[model samples]
Target chain A: MDFSSKLLEQAVDEVSQLPGIGKRTALRLVLHLLKQPESQTVQLSEALLNLRKNIKLCENCFNISDTQLCEICANTSRNSEIVCVVEDIRDVMAIENTNQYRGLYHVLGGKISPMDGIGPSQLTIKPLIDKVQAGKVEELIFALSSTLEGDTTNFYIFKQIERLEVKTSTIARGISVGDELEYADEITLGRSITNRIPFENSLKN
Target chain B: MDFSSKLLEQAVDEVSQLPGIGKRTALRLVLHLLKQPESQTVQLSEALLNLRKNIKLCENCFNISDTQLCEICANTSRNSEIVCVVEDIRDVMAIENTNQYRGLYHVLGGKISPMDGIGPSQLTIKPLIDKVQAGKVEELIFALSSTLEGDTTNFYIFKQIERLEVKTSTIARGISVGDELEYADEITLGRSITNRIPFENSLKN
Candidate 1:
């Protein structure tokens, strides 16, 4: 049977645009929302809209924030002398939820992927270098994934920071493999970050 | 671990509120968006906001719309003589995707459920009755499910329409059960709707 209304079609079309949500999943979501009270549906819409509109990246660490500097970067109570460098904001959150790290964060935006045409210049490495050279920092923790790209990024960052006389470390590798940070549970990621080891000179096993 | 930033915590807390997303899923989604080009992440945020801000329900059918009347109601090619009654807007879209039915629709908003305190008066049933009485409709198709609530709703609607002269019928049963209309595949739902049976007055089985 044909949908007699365009209004319903439009809602489904919009919902299907989300990641991993197909036409069928979008249909289910839209139908579920329609069954809810008007107020509740409105809240969902408002929350989704707010997720994008009200939040931004902190200029200091590049983590998502509602202000200029993300709360992690802005909090004075956090360790100002040690910065935990990560590939994305989610890493910052995972680490934060564990309450293990009190230091600040610097989001690399992404790892070095030459196949994807993402090189050293494309990342936020310059800011990290600058933050290190500006002094006060005694140790920099590398919270990157254990993927090939992540290893390459770690080596590249090590080369960049070696000239500055600061120590560099990376999150332990035993808990992760490949480009799979998205699937790592919080406890595993947390343990990896807490047990970070000194960055080695080579990328080989 | 204690979060270094309260803002990051707040954002994660907000993301967890979305349907089917737990804290870990929320973190993954948030981090994925963070790694994307700023423009793409910003676009997703804007889309979410627009979904809530711009889309409103059609005053007549309560289907989501960007305008006063949904596209189906405004279309001139659709037949105004028959109106298919459904439980929600999802049913409307399901029928539409078949490209079969060429008539209008009446969304009941929900099936009757005494446990949930949803009676006929709580739904758009009154509006449907009014629309039928005022229009030139010849057939009223009940596309509701065969669940207990659906049966009660169909019986109530049948009683009300008995006074009118329109040819009323319900979609075939024995095809689905246990409030399963929402789960029916489009083909099954479409076929059942096409092979609707007349409402029998006696329990002759």
Candidate 2:
């Protein structure tokens, strides 16, 4: 699309570089900003720049943080022995919202996706392995998604620390709490039946 | 959702301020930016700032431009006597893309919408009237949308220049090109039949 102003064109181009946003959408967004007060644009730009310039990763778990350590890793009351391994901070926020998990997290940054040129080395697998080897964690929970990439990342890390004394387990996969049995997928239904928990144990939750 | 970092939260908040972007989508976009090279964020922020600070409106037509006069207005080859009045710069671009009209444009910034607290005074209507009163334009074409606000704005402008010797016309309302007659809405289909053009006139385009 032809732009009358180079500044508008540049702004639209940069906005379209974001994931999921196309050229038309970028133009619409930029035009929206142009219509708003200049203070809105200034605040948005400053917030993005400040975030990029000063955001830090937790020294312990590699989660995004303002300080050297993330809140989860720094909390003393939380269980340090049981560490949940996941894809990124979004998962951390998801689990945290549940108010159920009290253990710390080890953010893998991303899963092992060879199709995307992301191997085990590209993730935070080494730091997690080192943490497990140091005998700080007693149990390591694999809370990654059930996709092929998630399994590959989980298996790769499991192989590295299989000889250690750490207890390893994956999150349970089954029909969601409110979902009906008729709507459940075949593989999930089969697994749910095969790995059915004891009746008394289901009541415990 | 809780963010691990305050910077991340701030960025997400600002991004969600945009139309159609919610908190979850904002977080996803912000996280995507975090994964990318820092330079990407810097460039996006800088581009927005530059556009907001340096972008100008065309002095003649009030279209968004980098200079005092837009490209169309600066070109002497185009017909200055015939002006198509539009709601905003996007309409100007759309009309330019058609390549059918060789006349210049007069961008009204926005239509008069009292529901949105937008009055004619808030738009560039006064300058447009002043231009018409100066005898610079021989014909004024109302190319605004067919919405209520568009009609109100058009009528208001027409009343202001009713005593002038200039000719006033509105863009034809009809079924879109390549659209089937069966699928056309009642109003558009009815209007198309009532205002049907001669076969030879239609063939001319």
Candidate 3:
């Protein structure tokens, strides 16, 4: 698209470089910023710049934080012995919102996706293995998604710590609570049936 | 969603302020930026800030520009006597992309929408009228969208210049060039039938 101003064009070009935004959407967003108060743009730019410049990763969990350690890692009340291993901070937020898990998290940053050139070394797997080997963790729960890369990463990490004393487990795979049985995928349904628990155990949650 | 870091939270909040972006998409975008090189964020932030701080509006046509006068308004080859009235710069860009019209443009910034508390006085309607009154324009074409607000704005401007010698017209409304007749909306089809152009005239384009 032909833009009247170079500044406008540059801004739209930069915004469209984002993962999902296209050129037209970027133009619309930039135009919106133009129509708004100048302070809005200033605050947005400052917030993004400050975040990129000053943001930190938790020393223990590798989750994003503003200080040396993240809030969850810094908290003394949460159980640090049991770490839920997952891909990125979004998973951490999702599990935290459930309010059921009391254990801390170890953010893997990403899965072992060879197609994307991301191997086990690109993730935080070594630090996690070090934690387990140091005897700081009692139980390690693999909370990654059920994709092939997720399973590969999980298996890779499990193999490294299998000889150690730490107990290893994975999050359960099952049909959603309110979903119909007929709609569940075959593998999930079969696993849910095979791993069935007592009726009293279901009522406990 | 709960964000672990205040810096990350503020960045997400600011980004979500853009139109059509929600908190979840905002978080995803922020995380994506965090994963990319720091220079990427710096360039994006600087581009936005520079655009908002230094952008200019063309004095003649009110289109966005980096100079006092826009490129189209500055061009001597374009027909200044024939001015196409549009709602915003997007319309100008769309028309420019067509490469069919040689006339200049007069951007009204927005249409007359009372529901949104926008009136003719809030737009660039006065400057447009002044241009016509100064005997600089021979023909004025209304190219705003075929909406209630657009029609109101067109009629309002037509009334102001009706007594003058300048001729006034509106862009044609019809089924799109490649659209199927069966799928065309009733109102557009009816208007297309009512305002059908001469068979010979249609062949000229």
Candidate 4:
């Protein structure tokens, strides 16, 4: 597209480089910014710069942090004996929103996807094994997505620490609470049926 | 959402302030940037800052520009006597993409919408009239959307410059080139039928 100003063109190009934004949407966003007060743009730019320049990752869990340890890893009241392994910080936020888990977490960075050239070596798998070898963790919970890559990563990590004293388990797969049986996918509905718990046990939640 | 790092949270909040972005999408974008090298984020942030700080609008047409007059206004070959008035720069880009219409443009910045507290005084309508009153323009083309506000803005500007010895016309409305008649809306079909041109004239393109 022919932009009247080189500066506007450069900014639109940069914004459109993001994952889902297209050139037209980028132009709309940039034009909206132009219509706003100058201070709004300043704050936006400064926030991004400060994040890239000053952000750090937790040494123990590899989650984003402002210091050596993340907030969850640094907290004393949370259970340190159980570690829920997730693919990224987004999973951390999702699990936290549920308010169901009280244990600490370990971010694997991503699942093992050979098709994408991301292997166990590229993630924090070794660090997780080292944590398990230290013997502080009594239970390791696999909380990755239900995709094939998630299962592969889970099995790979389980094998690495299998002989260790840690008891490993995966989050359950079942029909969501509000979903109808007919709407459920075959795999999920089948698992929910085969692994159906005793009626009284299901009432605890 | 709970962000372990304050810097990351701030960046996400800033990004989510854009028109269509939400908190989760903002977090995903921020994490994507974090995974990339530092220089990429730096370039993104700097581009936004530079654009907001250095950008200027054209003096004659009120379109975005780097100099006193925009490129179109400064071009010698384009007909300055014929002007196509639009709501904003997006419309200018849309018309330019068609590769027709060799006339210059006047961007009104926005249409007259009382619900949004926008009126003729809030737009560049006066400067457009000034252009016509200068006695150089021979034809004025209205190329706004067909919404209520677009029509209102078109008529408001038309009354302001009607006394001048210039011909005025709006861009034609009709069923799109590839669309079937059955799928076309009633108002559009009615207008297209009532405003039908000679069959030979339709073949000129």
Model 3: how far is A82 from its true place, Å? 0.6
Give the alpha carbon lDDT tens digit for every residue of B69-161 in model 3.
999999999999999999888999999999999999999989999999999898999999999999999999999998899999999999999
Candidate numbers sorted by TM-score from highest down:
3, 2, 4, 1
Please give, for residues A104-167, the per-residue lDDT of candidate 3 as tens digits: 9999999999999999888999999999999999999999999999999999999999999999
The stretch of ten residues in a row with the least summed lDDT in candidate 3 chain B is B196-205
User: Model 4, residue B83: what's the lDDT?
Assistant: 91
Query: Which residue pairs show collisions in model 2?
Result: none
- The worst-scoring run of ten residues by lDDT in candidate 2 chain A lies at A196-205
Model 4 agreement with the true structure over B1-205: per-residue lDDT tens digits: 7777889989999999999999988998999998889888889889989999998888888899889999999999999999999988888888998988799999999999999999889899988898899898999999999999999999998898888899999999999999999999999999999999999998978
- Candidate 4 Cα outliers beyond 4 Å, as residue runs: none
Q: What is residue A148's positional error in candidate 1, in angstroms?
A: 2.6
Local distance difference test, candidate 2: 0.93
lDDT of 4: 0.92
TM-score for chain A in each prediction: 0.74, 0.97, 0.96, 0.95
Clashing pairs in 3: none
- Per-residue lDDT tens digits for candidate 4, residues A45-132, read 9999899988888999999889898889889999999999999999998999999899999999999999999998999999999999
Candidate 3's fnat?
A: 0.95
Residue A30 in candidate 1 has what lDDT? Answer: 59
Q: Is 2 or 3 the stronger prediction by lDDT?
A: 3
State the TM-score for model 4: 0.97
**TM-scores of all predicted structures:** 0.66, 0.97, 0.97, 0.97
- Pick the lDDT winner: 3
- lDDT for A24 in candidate 4 is 95
RMSD in angstroms, candidate 4?
1.4
